[model samples]
Target: MISAGQASAWPKFAHILGHDEWIDMPEFQRVEDRVKNRVLLDPMIAEETSKFEKNVLLERLAEAKIAAAPVMTVADVANDPHFRDERSMYTEVTHPQLGPVRITNQAVKMSETNPYVRGCAPLLGEHNDEVYQSLGFTPEEISAWREKGVI
Candidate 1:
């Protein structure tokens, strides 16, 4: 496949990615095949089997002018300083059953009105009563609906 133009490289990649073109893009397939076969595939796999450091892989990719990052699992963020630090992309909220739990912080950063987590995810049926009441249901009616398994 032909190489993309040099200007605003990331935006083009983002545009293609946003359009979900990676699966169908011939360029992506070509690059994947090359990386998996011709280039440093065997050495990279060997390095992974032994040392297997994400940072090392990232550095190698950076050297090759490839922008990439290791796929991080949910547990990975808990131990990572970038996620758990004070200025992290994570925020803590109190869960009724689980106590304090960390979740994604507001993605949109605003200087004047910073966003925050109000509370952790609710437990099953936790908001049923409140929701029913808000919809003009009386406690008796809610209890009747609950008895009928409608909620």
Candidate 2:
């Protein structure tokens, strides 16, 4: 990942970044232009990063002290012991119809209260009548909409 302050970090990436036109621009404008036009940077980073394993690149970035984070795959996050065991990032809950299912736990931990996923999400159109009635539609009108498949 490119640092926002590109000049200070240039020596490390100069070989890969090459002498691009933006290299000479002032720091603020360089950062602004990069953000506005990722076409200027993303391809280069992608090409360079592709040469290294993801974890190796992450380690190199950390060594350079450039703020970077990995875009984790589902399998990576699910299987990582730090997330699965230490932090309890995922947990199994009894889904009403599907039986036990694994789901993400809340990210925040608190001293006063514990929050969790209550249940599986409601089925499609599960609360149609209740929602329509609360919005002032009559039960008959809601049923008519359902029959017409307009819901």
Task: Provide the overall lDDT of each model, using Cα atoms, as 2-decimal numbers.
Answer: 0.58, 0.71
Per-residue lDDT, model 2, residue 124, is 86
- Cα lDDT of model 2 by residue, 1-151, tens digit: 4463465565455433343444655532455565666765677667767887778766776777676777778998999899999888887888768899999998887879978878778888788789899999999998898799898
Cα lDDT of model 1 by residue, 16-129, tens digit: 324334324444345444345534434433443245356765565455455566678878966778666755678778877778877887766688998777777778878888
TM-score of each: 0.53, 0.63
Window of ten residues with lowest summed lDDT in model 1: 1-10
Model 2: how far residue 25 lies from native, Å:
10
For all candidates, the clash counts are 0, 0
